[model samples]
Target: MSASRYQDLVAKVDAKAKEFHERYAAQLQCKKGCSSCCQPGLTVFSVERLAIREWLNERPDLIEKLKAQPGNPKACSFLDDEGACQIYPVRPIICRTQGLPLSFKVNERTERDVCPLNFEKDDVLALPTDGVLNLDLLNTLLVLVDQVEGGSEAGQRFALNVDEVTRT
Candidate 1:
């Protein structure tokens, strides 16, 4: 998708993220040093590639670092020397919603997914479950916006590998 359109969508997602953090600050311990969810071999749609390309444009030094060290399939390419995300502000939707309470369908029943690091406290268990970001809806919106902005209109075709994106 076009950079401007992607930025708008990112802004909306970020706003929701901010709200989620505010609502569950104590329970969610996903801090900068925490890279447990940062794994490699992740696949993304074309729109995410476009967004990451935009993010890479500003961090030329990081690009050089990535060039010197090819992305490892077992580790996230965007992680810095300090284990912090190099493109945190412009990270993809999956990255943005990492530790939040996510719900999904399983065996014809609704199942809730929570990070093992989070919501362990009894007080947090009473927290509203509805506040978690709806990934299915978010992905649909991403594809819709991407198609509207001249991005690849492929349906559920996650063709872009994270390793390839880290290089060029």
Candidate 2:
């Protein structure tokens, strides 16, 4: 897939994420200035990195701010002074999917994941099945998009630092 194709896939993924957000709005209190999920340390794919880098090109201050922040913990670098995502519109699949009651198959077993703050401590089971995002499917789709764009089957990634992606 080309960059244009990648952008198309991102659009679809974002649409699905928006639906999930709407479906779970009753349980989710994740609004602006919420930094609970911003802690660092992550594996970001090449496609997502490129998208973010492109967005960052127009925001040099965000680049410098991210560079100055602590990077060892793997927190997102795109957060603004208020702890809200400055590039929320183009955040990666992971960032987009966070703070929701979601589930996936992990090594032949179904694992349900949810934000600690939401759902009142291990009440993830209470959320209707349809409300949770199937990250397993979404992630597989992302990997496929990466491969079609001439990236590795496993996907290209920069481990542990988001600022690394912004480097020229």
lDDT of 2 by residue, 1-168 (tens): 235766887787678767867876777777788878876666677777777777777788877777786643444666766788777866777877778778999799988887787776447866677877788888887888777663442376764244577765
Q: Model 2 lDDT vs. the true structure?
A: 0.71
Q: Estimate each model's TM-score.
A: 0.80, 0.81
lDDT of 1 by residue, 13-110 (tens): 88888888898888888889688887876666566776776667677887777667656666687776677887776677778888887766668675
Return the top candidate by lDDT: 2
In candidate 1, where is summed lDDT lowest over 10 consecutive residues?
A: 153-162
| Cα displacement (Å) at residue 77, model 1 | 1.4
